[model samples]
Target: MEWLVSGLIFLHVTSGAVALVTFWLPLLLPKGKQAHRVTGRVFAISMIVCGVIAMVLASFHLTSPQWVEGAADTRLQLGWMMLYLGLLATVLVLFGLKTVRNKGRHHLYKTTWILFLHGALALLAAWVFWLGWSQRELLLIGVAFIAFLMVPGNLRFILRKPVAAPGKLRREWLYQHFTSMIGAGIAGYSAFLSFGAAMYMPTHAFNPYLWTIPTILGVSFMMWLSKRQPRYD
Candidate 1:
C-alpha cells in the first residue's frame, strides 16, 4: 500500500510539473498556431493526469488516514485539500478545452460534466468545512470557504434560462478559456509550492498566504490579459 501511494505521488507530481511548464508555452506562443495548439493539448492532458492521481491519492488518505510522512490527522487534512484542488484543476481544464471545441457554443442549463462535478464538490466543500470547524483548523476552513464560493455560479447555470452570449463574435468562451486555464495554472503552482518548495522552506511553508499567492497573481494577470485581448462583439 505504501509503495502504491509513493508511485501515485510520483506520477501526480511529475504530471503536475509537465502541466505547469507546458501551460506557459501556449500563453507565450502566438494563438491559432500549431505550437500553441500542441502545447495547450499537452498541458490539458498532463493536468488531467495530475488531477486524477491527486483524487486517487486523496481517496486513499481519506479512507486510511495514515501516512509515513505526516500524522494521520495532517494526512487527512492534506487529502481533503488535494481532493478539492484536483477536482478544480480537472474541471477547469476540461471545460476550457470543451469551450474551444464547441466553437463558442456554451449552454449552462443542460447537464454537463462540469455542472455534475461542481455539484459534487459543493457537498464535499461543506463536509470539509464542517470537519475543519470541528477540529478548529483555520486553514482548512478558509480553503473550504474558497471552494464553496466556486459553486454559487452553478445556481446561475441551473436557475437562469440558458442563453448564449450576445453578438456574433461570442468572445465569452475565450474569456472562459483564459480564466479556466489560468485557474489550472494556479493549482499547479500551488501544488508545487506546497509540496516541492515546502521542503526547502520548512518554516512558514504551509502558510495559507503562501498557497494563495499564485491564485492572486494569476487572477490579476488574467484580468489584465483579458483587457488587452480583442473583444468578440
Candidate 2:
C-alpha cells in the first residue's frame, strides 16, 4: 500500500511533467490531432485518479497527524491536499459541462476560461510543489486575490482578434512558446518528484512557495530566457 500510494503519486508527477513539456509544442507544431487528444485523455484520467487517491490516503498518512497545536505542523500537508482537491474539482466541472449551443461566442469563451483555469492552477501548483518552500498563508491569499484580477486580462489576450493571421502568428510565436513550455515543465516536474520523495517528516510540502535553490534558479532562468523572440516583429 505504501509503494502503491507513492507509485501513483510518482506516476501522476511523471505524466504532469510530460504533459507540460509537450503542452505548447503540440499546439504550435505539426502534431497529429488524434495522438494529442489521446494523450490528453490519459493525462486527465491520471490527474483525476491522483487527486482521488491522495484524498483517501490523506487519512492514513501517519506522518503529520491532523491539526495539532504545534507538534509537527501537519496542516501544511493538509493545505496542499486541499489545493489538490480544488484543482481536481475545477477540472471535473469544466470537462463535465459541454454544449453545442454556445458555439460561436459563449462556448468558446467559457471553454477557454475553464481550460485556462485548469492549466494555470495545475501548472502553478506543480511549480510550487517542485520547489519545496514555505507556505506563508498571507502571501498565498494575497496572490490568490490578485490572480482573479489577472484572469479576465488573460482571457482578453487569448480571445482577442490577432493583428496577424493565424499562420503568421503560428510561425512567429510557436517555437518560443514551445521552448518555454519544455523548460518550465522540467522545473515543475522536478519539484513534484522532490516533494514526494521528501514527504518523509518535515516535508517541504506545506511551504506554499517553492524554495529549492536549483528549482528556483531553474525556473527563473527558464522564464527569463526560455524563448527567443525573432528580430523581425
Candidate 3:
C-alpha cells in the first residue's frame, strides 16, 4: 500500500509539472492555431491526470489508520483538502472544455453528469468550510470560500439562457471558456506552490499570506485577460 501511494505520488507530481508548463503555452501562443490547440489539449489532459491521482491519494490518506483511530492531524486535513481541490480542478477544466465545444448551444452543456458534478462540489465546499471552522485551519477555510466563489457563477452559467442578441452567445461562451481555464490554472498553481512550500519550507507551509499569493496573482491576470476580446481564430 505504501509503495502504491508512492507510485501515485510520483505520477501526480510528474503530470502536475507537465500541466504547470503547458498551461501557459495556450495563452501565450496564437489562439486557434494548431500549436495552441495541441498544447491546450496536453494541459487539460495533464490536469485531469493530476486531479484524479490527487483524489486517489486523498482516499489513502483518509482511510489510513490514524484517521480510522479518529486522530486529528495534518494528514487528515490534507485528505479533505485534496479531495476538494482535485474535484474542483477537474470540474473547472471540463467546464472550460465543454463551453468551447458547445459554444452557442449553452443548453447542450447542462447534462445530468455535469449538473451532478457541480452539486457535489457545492456540497463538498460546505463540508470543507465546516471542517475548517471546527479545526480552526485557515487554509481549509480559505479554500472552501474559493470553491464557494465558483459555485454561483457556474450555476448561473449552466442554468441561464443567453440573451437573444447577435454575437452575445458567442461572447458568453468565449468568456466562460477563458474564465474556467484560468480558474483551473489558479488551482494548479495553488497546489504546486503549497506542495513546494510544504516540502522545502515547512515553516512557511501553513502561512496564510503564502497561500494567498497564487489566488492574488491568478485573479489579477484573469481580470486583465477578461478585458480583452480574444480571437477564437
- Top candidate (TM-score): 3
Candidate 3: RMSD to truth: 2.7
Candidate 3 structure quality by residue, lDDT tens digits, 1-233: 66787789999999999998999999889988999889999999999999999888888778875333233586677778888888888998998899879887867977998899989999998998898899887878877777787767878888987665555334677777877787787778877776677668866665667658878877787778877765232
Measured by lDDT, the strongest candidate is 3
Model 1 segments beyond 4 Å from truth? 107-109, 129-138, 145-168, 197-205
Q: Candidate 2 versus the native: TM-score? A: 0.42
TM-score of each: 0.84, 0.42, 0.91
lDDT of each: 0.74, 0.42, 0.81
Candidate 3's TM-score reads 0.91
For candidate 3, the per-residue lDDT at 228 reads 79
Between prediction 1 and prediction 2, which has the larger TM-score? 1
Candidate 3 runs further than 4 Å off: 66-71, 166-169, 230-233
Pairs in steric clash, model 3: none
